[model samples]
Target: MLDDITELNENTTFVEEAKTIDEEDLYPFPTSEDEPTTKRFLGMTPAQLFVISIEFFFMVLIFGVFFMIVTERMTIPF
Candidate 1:
């Protein structure tokens, strides 16, 4: 009477399910096989490098002006 229902073992059935899912590409991100990765300079992307450079330039300019004022080269009226 139990012949109608086939045996379903957790170990065997889980392995089969895992294999099928692995074969399917339901992932949202691209795999290494999809495209070649690009290299970064100083481990930063172009946009990041541009923003950091701009910040550095402003910091240098502000400090240079302050130094000139303290040395009496450039005067600021009180």
Candidate 2:
């Protein structure tokens, strides 16, 4: 590690200026002013709808496994 650090120190292009984000940084999505924008449901955006769909999928998967265990495993005698 010490030899590696020494070799890295010999290189002059290691340092660089860090770029800072400002308020002017906007998302790359395009929105047109002339098009009528549909209102969000309960203030939920499309991204939130996608996330909710993923959550529901996982919930169904977990419950399916849980119900299968209750039905299949509980039938065994103690």
User: lDDT of all predictions, in order shown?
Assistant: 0.78, 0.65
Q: Candidate 2 clashing pairs?
A: none
What would the per-residue lDDT of candidate 2 be over residues 1-78, giving only the tens digit for each residue? 234654564434433211333324543454575445887776789999999999999999989878877889535356
Give the 10-residue window scoring lowest on summed lDDT in candidate 1: 1-10
Which ten residues in a row are the worst by lDDT in model 2? 14-23
- lDDT of model 2 at position 24: 41
Candidate 1 per-residue lDDT, tens place, 1-78, comes to 134346755465555755666533667687777755786788898999999999999999999999999999999987
Question: Clashes per prediction?
Answer: 0, 0
Task: Candidate 1: give the clashing pairs.
Answer: none
RMSD of 2: 13.4
Q: Distance from true position, residue 28, model 1, in Å?
A: 28
For each candidate in turn, the TM-score is 0.49, 0.43
